[model samples]
Target: MTINQAIRILDPDTSAEALGEIEYYGGLRGKEKVLVACDEACRIAVEIMRQHLKE
Candidate 1:
């Protein structure tokens, strides 16, 4: 899948500016890209949960 598709799948709320800032992973294949996206998404989710728990 393309970066745009991956971002939509991983975080639909992501802004256009954020999308522009994201570095291209030219070396990664489809599977690697998906894995990386999932990993980053999970990390972001965990951070959000932690912030909520603190409040």
Candidate 2:
């Protein structure tokens, strides 16, 4: 995902760890936080996809 779209990229290996980071960043947790996380995730997805597309 483009850096413009989000802060850090999340991975399966660090999903749990990232969850905690997100909670602290968003200042909340649970489903609500997941909803808010969409924007960030979308940014990451776009960045990764775009980079792959570049090659």
Q: Number of the top candidate by lDDT?
A: 2
By TM-score, how accurate is candidate 1? 0.51
TM-score per model over all chains: 0.51, 0.44
Best by TM-score: 1
Each prediction's Cα lDDT score? Answer: 0.56, 0.63
Q: Rate residue 32 of model 1 by lDDT.
A: 64
Candidate 1: lDDT of 48? 69
Per-prediction backbone clash count: 0, 4
Query: Judged by lDDT against the true structure, how good is candidate 1?
Result: 0.56
Cα deviation at 54, candidate 1, in Å, is: 0.2
Q: lDDT per residue, candidate 1, 5-48, as tens digits?
A: 44565665763434333434424464565456667766666676
Q: Which 10 residues in a row give candidate 1 its minimum summed lDDT?
A: 17-26
Any residue pairs clashing in model 1, and if so which? none
